[model samples]
Target chain A: MEKIISLHNQHVKDWKKLLTRKQRKKTGTYLLDGWHLINEALTANVNVKSLIITSDQLEEHDDIVTRDFPIYEVTDEIMRAITDTVTPQGIAAEVELPTDQFDIPESSRGAWLFLDQVQDPGNIGTMVRTADAAGFTGVVAGSKTADLYSPKVVRSMQGSQFHLTLRHGNLDEWIELFKKQHFPIYGTQLNPEAKNFRDVAPAGSFALVMGNEGNGLSDNILSQTTSNLYIPMNGRAESLNVAVSAGILMFQLNQNIK
Target chain B: MEKIISLHNQHVKDWKKLLTRKQRKKTGTYLLDGWHLINEALTANVNVKSLIITSDQLEEHDDIVTRDFPIYEVTDEIMRAITDTVTPQGIAAEVELPTDQFDIPESSRGAWLFLDQVQDPGNIGTMVRTADAAGFTGVVAGSKTADLYSPKVVRSMQGSQFHLTLRHGNLDEWIELFKKQHFPIYGTQLNPEAKNFRDVAPAGSFALVMGNEGNGLSDNILSQTTSNLYIPMNGRAESLNVAVSAGILMFQLNQNIK
Candidate 1:
C-alpha cells in the first residue's frame, strides 16, 4: 500500500485529469470512481493501474488490500480533488481507456441505435445502460456526442461499456457501410414524411437513429433514414426525453424483429 | 416590476424553503426554474404565483419581457437562495400545484401511467414527460414519491407537468378505484412470475404502474394488478431504468390500444 498525502502527487494529478476527454485521450487511460464500476472492471479482467481510496474508507475496506493492483490511500480532501462527483465517493480506480476492437458481428444483425450529437453526460450514460438492456448492438456515438471514457459516462453506463462492443463511427461512413451490407436506418421525428414506428420496421438488419436533446435527427441523418418513425401521443408533451425515446424505439424494434 | 435588494425578505426566505418537500406542500406552490419551463407554464396558462429573476438576466432580456406577470428582480445571491440546480439558469417561476381540474371526457379511454413510490425526482420528472408524449390520459404519482413540485422534478419534466394532468393519489385507494372501474393494471416488474408486456393489452382502459427506485411495487398494489408486465432484456442489466421501462411499456400499450 502506498500513502499519497500530497495533492500534487504527479500520478494523482494525472489520474484526476483523466476526468476530461482531452486528458484521457492524451494519456490513454480513464478514471473510474465508485465501487461498482471498479469491481466490474476487476471481474472482467480489465487491467487496473492502481486503486485510490480515501483514508476513512481505507480502514473499512479490508478486501482491497490483497488485490494485485497497487493501492494508494489518500485523505478525503485529496480524493475530492481527483473526483468530479459533488459528494465524492471514497473509491477510485485507473484503467486504460478502451479502444474499439470488435468487428461488427456477421451473426449480430437487428436493431442498431445511432446517436447524433447527444451531449448530456447523464443522458448518454442512461442511454448506454438502456441500450445494453434493450439488446441493441452497441450504440454508435457520432462525432458530436460526449466522450465514452469520461468519468460521468463510465458511471452512467453502470458498467455497460464493459459488456458490449463500442465503435466511434462517423454517421455518414457508418451509413454507407451498413447500406453496402444491406442494412437500413430508422429514425424518430414529427415530420409528416415519417411513418409511425409501428408501421415500418424492416426485416433482418437496421439501425435506429436518435438525435440531440433539443433537436431531433440531423437533416443529413434524417435524409439517410430509410424510414422516419413517430410514436403516437395524445398528451400535450412535445416529445419524450431523448434517451427514453431511444429506449422505447430500441426495445420496440428488438421485440418486433424476431 | 418589483425590485428587492435584501436577501432577508420574508417571501424570499419562505420561497427558499421550497427546496424541501415539506416546505413546498406547506405553501402549495413550488419553484419552476429555467426559461423553457417558465415559458411552458405561461403557455399552458398555469396559474403563476410569481416570477423570480436575477437582475442581470432581466436587464438583458428587456425585449422578450418588460411585461406579463409580477416580475420580482432579486440579486444573484438571492436567486441562488431558491434554486435546486447546480448552476442557476437565472429564471424561475412559482406555479399553482396542479390539481385534477380537467375532466377526462367519456371518450377518453386508454392506458395511463401510475408511478408508485418512485422517490427519484429526476426519474419522476422524466416519466411524467414520457407519459405525456405516450398520450396517457394522465399520470398519478402516489405516496413516498419525490414531491412533484421539487425543482429537480420540475426541470426534468421539461414543462410536461403543466401540459399534463398530474395529481397525487393514495396508492391503495387508487388501486381499489381502478379495480372498481375495471381498468386493467399493468404493473412493471422483472419477477419470473410476471407476464411479457407484449402478451397483455387491457381490453378495457389500463394503467401502467411503475414502482419505487430501490424497492419496486409493494405487495399490496401488486396484488391489485390485473396485468403484470415485464420489459424483456437480453443483457447483464436485468432491469431497465424505471422511467425508460415505463416509457417503453407506455409506447407499446399506446400502439396496441390504438
Candidate 2:
C-alpha cells in the first residue's frame, strides 16, 4: 500500500487546505473525518476522491482500504496535520462537493425548509437533520448561512446531509417560486400579529422559513409569507433555540400531513 | 464602592473557586456571567450574593450596582481571573443555588420532564429550555446528567433555568413515584416494540424520560416504563439529536394540553 510520512507531501498540503472555506470552494472538495462520516459517504455513494488512514487504523478499516479509490497510509503526526478536529480520528476522506443547482419543481408537493443567514454551524446542521427526519423534500441555505461542508456542521449533521437534497440559493427567489406555485410559505417570527403555529393546518406541500439566531425573519422575507406563525412560549425564555423551534415546527407540520 | 485590584484577595479567591463543581456545591453558590444572566437573576428575584464588575462596566450597569447587595469594582486582570470564558463579559455575579427538594405533587396534573444520564451540557440545557417553553411544571435531572450549573449548560439555557423548577435526583425513584400516581410515563427508545409517538394521545399530566446521547435509556429503566415511544424516522438518518427529539416530544405533548 502507498504511504505518506511527510507533512510536506503535495497530497498532505492539499488535504490540509480543506480546512478553509475558500480552499474547499476553490477545489470543489472537502474532508470528512472519523469512521462514521467516511462510512456514510461510501454507503451513500458520494464521490470520494481518496482515503487517508493512519497506519494503525488501516487493518481495522481493511474493507475501505481495499476499495478502488487511492488509499494512503500515514503516520499519526501526518494524520493530525491534515484534520481540523482537536482529536484526530486517524481516518479521513476527500469527497467531491455536490454543486448541482436544484430547480424548483413544476408542482410543489412536499415540504421544503429555507434557512436565512443562520450563522451557527451546529444550528444549521441540526436544522437540516431535523428536516430530513420530518421527510422534507430538501433544504435551501440562503447566502450568509454557515458553509454546509464545514467540519463542525458535518459532525453535528450525523450524515443526514447524504440523505436529502441540500443546495445553496437566494431564499427570496425560492420564496417567489413557491408562492407562484400556490404553496403556502410560512415564516416563523415573534411578531404580535403572528398566528400560533398550532392554528395553521398542515398541507401536503409548503415551505418553512427559519431565520438568524438573534433576529427573526428579515422584514423582506416576512412580508412575502402567506402568514407568519409563532410557537407559543408559555414560560419566561425570550425565545427558543433556532434549531429546537425548527424541529418542533417540522415534526408537528409533518404529523398532520402523514 | 470597594475596588479590588489584587487577584490574591480572599474574596476574589473564593469567587474564583465557583468555577469548579466541588466549590460551587460546598458554598451553595455559583457564578453568573455576562449582563444577560445577571439581569435574569435580578428579574427573577433570585438571591444575589454579590456582584463583580470591571471598572469600565460599572457606569453602564449602574442600576444593578446601586442595588442593596455588595458590589465590587475590579481591574480587568482581576475580572479575567474569575471568569471561565475567554472573552470575559466584564461583569459577573455570585448567586445562591436553588437547593429546594421538589416533591411529586399529590394531584399530579402538570407535565414534568426527566432526563437520564444525558451527559452533553448543551443537550441538557436545551432540553431544560424546551421544557420551559412547553410549560412543563419542572425538570428532574438524573444523577448522571451534566451539572445543572455548569457554564456551558447555563449559556445554552439562556436563563430558562430561572423560570422553572429544576432539580437533580434518581430516575428510578422518580419513575416509581410517577407510576404510583397513575401518571403515564413514556420512555423514548427505538425498540421494535416501541409505539409511534403520534399514536399516543397527549395527556394533561405525565413524565417523559429522555436518555443518554449514546446508549438511550438503560434496560432497567426501559423495563419500568408504561410504554416505550419512538419518533418515526422517514429518512435515512439513524436517530435525531437528543435535544431536537426532546423538543419535538415536549411541544407535541404540550399541544394537547392547551
Candidate 3:
C-alpha cells in the first residue's frame, strides 16, 4: 500500500485545496470528508477518483483498499491537514463533479425544487435532502444560489446528493423547459394575488421555487411562474426559514404519492 | 453617554462572558447581538436590561439611547471582542432570561412541539421558528436538547423566541400534563404500527414530539403517545433533516388554521 506522511506531498496539498470553490472547479472534483459520505458515494456507484485514509482506519476499510481505486494511507497529521473537522474522521474521497443539467430528461415527471439566490449552504443542502425524501425528480440550484458542492453543503446534505439529481443552471432556462412540458411552476411569495398553497392540487409534475433568505424571489422569475403561492401563516412570525418552508411545500405538493 | 473604551472594563468583561453557557446561566441573562435583533427585542417588549453600542452607531440609534435602560458607548474593538461574528454589528443588548415553564398554563390549548435530545443549536432554533410560524402555542426543549439561549441558537432563531412561549422542562411531565387535558400526543417514528401522519386530522390542540438528529424518538416516549406516526417517503433518502421534518409535520398538523 502507498503511504503519504508529509503535508507538503503533492497529493496532500492538492486535496487541501479542494476546500475552496475555485480549486474544486479547477480540478472538476471535490473532497468528500468522513467515512459516511465516502461510503455513500461508493455505494451509489458515483465516480470516486481516489480514497484517502489514516493509517489507523486502513484495516477497517480494507475492502475499499483492495478495490481498483488508488488508496493512500497517511498519518493522522496528514489526514487533519486535508480536512476541516476538529476531529478528522480519518477517511475521505475525491469524487468527480457530476455534469451540470442542461435539459430535463423525457422520463422526468415529479416535483423539482428550485433555489433562487438562496445563500446559506446549510439551507441549500437541507432543501436538497427534503426534496429527495419527498421523492422529487431533482433539485436545480440557480446560478445565484450557493455552490452545491461546497464542504458545508456536502456535510449537511448527509449523503442525499448521491440519491437525487442535483444540478446548477439558469433558472429562466429551467423554467422554460418545464413550461414546454405543461408543468406548473409555483413561486412562493406573500403578494395579495397569490393563491393559498393548499388550494393547489397535489402534483405529479411541477417546479416549486424558493428565494433568498433576505430578499425573496427576483421580480423577473416571479413574473414568469405559472402561479405564485403562499403558505398561510396565522402566527406572528415574520416568515419561516427558507429550507423549512420548502420542505412543507414539497411534502404538501407531493401528497399524490401513495 | 457613558463610554467604555477598554476591553478590560468590568462591564465589558462581564458582557463577553455571556458567550459561555455557564456564565449566561449564572447571570440569568444572554446577549442579543446586531441592530435587527435588538430592534426586534424592543418591539416584542422583551425585557432589555441594558444596551451596548459602538460610538459609530450611537447617533443613529439615539431613540434607543434615550430610553430608560442604561446605555454604554464602547470602542469598536471592544464590540468585536464580545461578539462571535467576523464583523460585529456595533449593537447588542443584555436581556433577562425568561423562567422555564414548570407547568402548562391553565388556558394553554394548541399545538406544542417538543424537542427530545436534539443537539444541534441551529436545528433547535429553526424548529422553534417553525413552531412559531405554524401558530403553535409554544415549544418545549427537553433536558437533553441544546441550550435554547446559546448565541448560535439565539441567532438562528431570528427572534421568533419572542413570538411564542419557549420553555425548558421534562418531556415526561409535559406529556403527562397534555394527556390530562385529553390532547392527542403524536410521537414521530416509523414502526409497523405507526400511522401515516396524513391520517391524523388537523386539530386545535395536540403535542408533536421530534427526537434526536441521529436517533428517532426514545422508546419510552414512543410507547406512551396516543399514536406514533411517520411521514411517508418513497425516495432514496434515509431520513430528512430534523428541522425540515418538524416544519413539514407542524404545517400539516396546523391545517386547522383558517
Candidate 4:
C-alpha cells in the first residue's frame, strides 16, 4: 500500500488513464478498485503488483497487509479522485494483463462466452460473475469492449473475473483461431432461422458469442460461428440486455455441455 | 423549442433530480433521452405527456411531433445539465407515470415479474425490457427496488415500460392480490428443493419473483411465492444475473402458460 496525495503523482495519473480505451491499449494494465475485488484477485492467485489503501480499511485486512508493505494514508478526497464509484471503498489495486482467450486449452467441457464489443463495464463484470456461476470456461471480451480491470468492471464482476479466464482483443482473429481448432461457436441472432436455445443441446466443445449490447455481431464474427441461435422470446420487446442474454445462453448451453 | 439558460430553471433542475429516486417519486414523471428511446415510446404508444427536443432532431421526426406542448430548446451545455449521458441525443422526453401494471385485470393472458430490491437501475430496466419481451403482462417493482423513473432506468427500459404495465409499490400486498385472484407466483431460488425451470408448469396466469443482484430473493417474497424455481446450470458458476434468470424463467414459464 502506498499513499498517493497528488493527482499528478506518476502512478495515480497513469492508472486514471486506464479509464479510456487508448490508455489501456498503451499501458497494457488497468486499475481495480474496492477491497473485495483485490481480495478476489488474490484468491484467484493473481499477482498483486501494487495496492493503494487508506488507513481505515487497512486494519480490517491486517492479515493481507504485513509489516513488509506500507499502507497508504490518503484522505477520502484523494481516494475518490482515484475511483468512479459514488462511495469509494478506500482501496484500489493493479494487476497484470490477462492472457489471450484463444490460448485456452481444449477442456472438452462447459460453455465458453464470447463478447463482441459488449461495451458497458457493469455488463462485462456481471457476465463474468454469471459465467462463473453458470460453470463456463470463461468470458472473452472482444475489442472495443469496456476494460475488465476498470473499477466498474472489477466491481460488477464481483471477483468472478479473477476466478475466470477473461481474455480480450480482436474477436475476428480469435474466432478464426477457434474455428481452426474445430471449436463450435454459437452466435446469437434474431431471425426465424435461429434455433431456440432450449432446443439446442448445450453440451459441446463450443463457445457462445454475445454481440454488442445494441448492434449485435458483425457479419465477420457471425460468419465464423457454427450456429446462430436465439433465446426464445414470446413478447413484443426487441431484445434482452447483453449481460442477461449471456447469462441465459450460458445457463442453457452449460446444460448440454455437461 | 424554448431555450432556458439558467441552471436553476425549474424544469432543468427537475430533470437532474430524476437521477435520484426521491425526487422522481415527488413528481410522477421521469426523463427519457435519445432518439431511439423517444421513437420507441412513440411506437409503443406509451404515454408521453411531454417531449423535449432540439429543433434539429424535431425536424427529422415530424411524424411524432405535434408542436402541442413544452419543447425545451436547450444549448449543448443546458442539455448536459439535464441529461446523465455524455450526449443527450439532441432530444429528451418526459414520460408519464406508468400505473397500468396494477390494472392487468387478473393476469388473463401473460405472466408477471415481481422484483425485490434489485436496486441497480440498469438491472431493473433490463428486467422490465425482458419481462416485456418474454410476454409478461407487467412488472412490479417491489419495495426497496430501484426507482422505475430514474434516468438510467428510463434509458435501460428503452420504452419497454410503456409497452407493459410497470409499477413500483408494496410487493407483499401485490402478492396477496395475486393469491386472492388465485394466480400462481413463481420465485427463483437456489434451494435444492426448487424445481428446474423447464420442469415446472405454470397456469394461465403467473408471476416470476426475482431478488437482488447481490442477495437472492428475500424470505418475505420467497415465503409468499407458490413455488421456488431454479435455472439449472451444468457448470461451476454459482448463480446467474437476476434479470437474466427472470428472462429464462419468464420464457420457460410463458411457454407453459401459453
**Among all candidates shown, the one with the greatest lDDT:** 3
At residue B112, what lDDT does model 3 achieve? 89
Candidate 1 lDDT: 0.78
TM-score of chain B of each: 0.89, 0.93, 0.94, 0.88
Place model 4 in a CAPRI quality band: medium
Candidates' lDDT values, in order? 0.78, 0.85, 0.86, 0.74
lDDT of 2 by residue, A1-258 (tens): 589888899999999989898999898898998989988898888898888998778877677756889989998988878886667889999999886734544555678899988999999999988888888888888886778888888888888888888888888888888888788999999865888887776767788999999987888888889988899887667788899999888887776664
Instruction: Give candidate 3 misplaced runs (Cα > 4 Å).
Output: A100-108, B100-107
The CA lDDT at A80 in model 3 is 79
Candidate 3 global lDDT: 0.86
Question: In terms of lDDT, which candidate is stronger, 2 or 3?
Answer: 3
Q: What is the C-alpha RMSD of each candidate to the true structure, in Å?
A: 3.4, 2.3, 1.9, 3.3
Clashes of each: 1, 0, 0, 13
Tens digits of per-residue lDDT, candidate 1, B1-258, equal 788889789878888888887886777777888898878878888888888888788878875455566788888788877785567888888877765532233333556777788989889999989888877777777866667777788778888877667767676666666677777777877876788877765455778889987788888778888868887787776567788888888877776565
What is the RMSD of candidate 1?
3.4
Q: Measured by TM-score, how close is model 1 to the native structure?
A: 0.89
> Model 2: iRMSD?
1.0
> Residue-wise lDDT of candidate 1 within A172-218, one digit each (tens)?
77777678777878878976567777666455778888899988888
**Residue B45 in candidate 3, Cα distance off native in Å:** 2.9
Model with the higher DockQ, candidate 1 or 4: 1
Lowest summed lDDT across 10 adjacent residues in model 4 chain B is found at B100-109
Tell me the spans in candidate 1 whose CA falls farther than 4 Å from its real position.
A54-64, A86-89, A101-110, A256-258, B53-69, B75-77, B84-91, B99-110, B256-258
* DockQ values of all predictions: 0.72, 0.76, 0.86, 0.63
Candidate numbers sorted by DockQ from highest down? 3, 2, 1, 4
